[model samples]
Target: MSTPTAGQLALADRIAHGGPAPVAAISHVAAAAYTDPARWAAEKTALFDRLPQVIAPSALLPRPNTAVPHDGFGKPLLITRDADGRAHVFMNVCRHRGTRLVEGMEAQYAPRLVCPYHAWSYALDGKLVGLPRADSFPGLDKTSYGLVELPSRETSGLIWFAFATDADFTAASAVGPDFDAFGLGGLHLFRRHTHDVAANWKLIMDAFLESYHVQRLHAGTIGPFFKDGVTAADKIGPHQRSAVGRVAELAALPPGDWPALRAAVTFAYQLFPATVIVVSPDYVNLMVLMPRGHDRVLVEDFMLIPEAPATEKARDHWQHSWDLLDTGVFGGEDFRAATLGQQGLESGAIEWLTLGTLESGVRHFHEEIESRLNTG
Candidate 1:
């Protein structure tokens, strides 16, 4: 379909109220950029390869009865608590010669992780404890041989880590004034889910950008609230927040609460890499899109509600909201398959693809990708 010109967006707002949304037309962007192998190669090296894949240490917040995934390569990483009730993230590796320090699911709040490789060990704080044959490496200074430590922090109900090695972490992460202003930490963990999808990482982000697909892809469910051509966009840091107001909430909104009504209206935050943070009046859904490769991506969806619903009635209330989202936005299998098939275009199969202006959100996404790749 041909994309609409920039001029059509204003009209799209009106069409979403009643008329059909015309196909989008995009300029100042190109389709090959999102699909090109050469460009993809450049992306991996230029920006992504240079950026650290680690998160802040504090992001490992587990629910009262839940355990965070602490998978690691060196010394099995351990995330547990001590008697003091403080949470900690530590390496499960031995201090002697890089042996794994701990194994298995639950290691008690032990002060030290003993290495079975040579009976060498490390304190829970990562200090070198002992070497069964301490004289074997006599000149070795045990203090300098502690397990590799990582920098970390916790915020907004999630743990954030700096995967990059001493790379001025403060500037690399996206936590700052804007996030504080939004008061993201106020929300609580509610629910979570995981989905393995067949598409480029960006395709997952694109799935939530424009409301245009709702009328067609989700005609029976979420369609009534969102329509083609009706949405707004704003970018902060590396995150983009797009929103479309819903009419369903208006019906029950208590008298004269304009501010609350506005707050209840939309889904926001399409953060970089692959994280979609949906903020609603009742709950918060944070979706992490982890790229497996150029064509395979996995989405980890975590819902943070005002509180976890232990009762069935409360659970249903939370499910009702996400049920619409699951079948509607999360159901992008067919769309992704189509994009993947386009990979054949590189083989002289097709000359070019198109983008509609109404779908400029997609264009904006590519522009951001291009900017990062080129500048990095």
Candidate 2:
């Protein structure tokens, strides 16, 4: 049995005492924060554009010469691994006419990035290598026409990209020790689901930051398995790690089993700017929130396991977990509520959304956003 970390031990102690995580105060944010176009624009400029975002798990591009195209935070991004196994990130557009590159090519490995428009080709490392009728455009400098590179870094099995080309990024340090402990890179991507929610991206984030709604909103699925409104919240820079205790199961464990105490809690790690990485006993669920508009967000859900299930029984178990998430808590309850919340906020039915002590995670998240928005 492995010893519990300071965080797990502290959380277990708090749960044993039946105390809620410490809170500052209840807070409120304007309802227009969900429906106002100007507010959303400000968020994009001040928050998303200026901060580093986890765009993908490093496992997604595990091999050399592999690439993935993304439109994250409204910016076209192309992430690739070169033949030498180095990661590269670029503006997913051709330098010639700004044509979107790698539109539908899906073989997982590309010898070269070929623009479908004029056949402007680039090497796996993003250097411009080919162009049709090269002599016709004598002034075209191949050296200067490479794909536009974006500031990106990979660490702890994740890829992070910032909109600014010279953005300062420290992926491992930003995520803290919790990231390394999760063995995130060791997890294999078992399945992925994409969702478009009809609510502000913040609303989507709010749903995962607290368990206050687990008893009320997720009563049918995950609620009964854990305590209600009882959680331990710890901050990692702008991020947080929140844990809810498993009352029934923990009580069943034998006394003096210190290591087993760690297994009796479920953790949700909020990766600042917009991702929630939830650690379960057997698997990990990474949820990314990207705003499509003021009242719309695109969510990408990735389910991961230590490895691909080898036995029929193992496969069945994972499949059932996927089904539960797809049909219950996430797809059914949370998103449905977010859409309804959007409709209400857009209809001018509320002045401000209120938060209580139990909902301190939601409050702190908004405070972080406000803090970043106020930064230069």
Candidate 3:
């Protein structure tokens, strides 16, 4: 494992000393923020569309000449790595007749993308390479007709893209060094599951931003493994990074031992806008929350491990971790709570939701959103 960052070590030092997690002033957010359609529309435009968004982990397209289709955010996108080992993002539609070029979510060894409708082909770098019946279209320039490319960057073992061509990606790049310390780019994709939750996207993101709900909401599943309401958090641009776990154990570990520290505490990251990375002792979970509407979200959950299983025992161990997180902890607890919260907020029983000091991360996340929406 890579060595821990100074920030991580500082958090551990605080935990060892029994220092209280930093607290924020009590705050409240309008209930309409989660229930109003207009607010949701504005957020999609200002945040999701304008800001750089995570496309997928770099491990998804593990090698050159590989491709995958992504529509999790409701926009058909194709992610590819060229033979020269460069990553690119383009509209999934074929330039000829606008037919969807790639159909599935799994990455494949695709040297070139071929349109199923008319056999029009495109290179991994989005160049239109071949087409049938060249005489049919005289003076047609293939170079000018390449797939529509989007602004994209591959950093810290992840792929990020933006809808706007002029979008600044500095905020997304800020989190790369920390992620690299966790070896995120070299991990293996163990499993992936999709959840269509009846809740706003922010609600789902709010769940990961704070550890206040981990003990109570997940009491039966993952609660016992974590300390009660003890967490340390800071921000990287609009992104929030938090740590929660056995404080005593973390405090006792020798300094600079990140692997041992990881085994004692769980690190969670809420990437700006709507992506989450949870680093557990043995594996990492990436959750991409795509807002479908004011009251709906599509969550793509991925579990990544250090390497492929080499034995049946290894496979069993990884399978157990996957089941505990994907099926029990997140699917059963976190998502269920988000959907339930949505139902209550929609009933008009309350005008605003009170946020306690422990939920400061959630409030900070909202403030970040408000800053962008008001300015944009």
TM-scores of all models? 0.69, 0.89, 0.96
- Provide the overall lDDT of each model, using Cα atoms, as 2-decimal numbers: 0.55, 0.79, 0.88
Number of the predicted model whose lDDT against the real structure is largest: 3
Ranking by TM-score: 3, 2, 1
The candidate 2 region of ten consecutive residues with least summed lDDT is 1-10
lDDT of 2 by residue, 206-267 (tens): 98887778888988888877744357788777887888776555656675565465467677
Task: Return the lDDT, model 3, position 199.
Answer: 96
lDDT of 3 by residue, 159-260 (tens): 999998899999888888888888998999888888999999988999998778877898888888774425788888889898876666876788887788
Candidate 1 per-residue lDDT, tens place, 1-376, comes to 1222232222223323434444456654444655666766786665444443332222224322222324432224655443333454555555556665666643244555567777776665556777777777879998898767655544434444444455343433453333343355555555555666656666667766666666776666657655522465655555566656644454455654444544545546666655676666556677766565566565666666656678999889888776656544565433444356545543555554455665677667777777888687
Error of 3 at 166 (Å): 0.9
Each prediction's number of clashing residue pairs: 25, 0, 0
The alpha-carbon lDDT assigned to residue 231 of candidate 3 equals 75
Better of 1 and 3 by lDDT: 3
Show the lowest summed lDDT stretch of 10 residues, model 1: 1-10
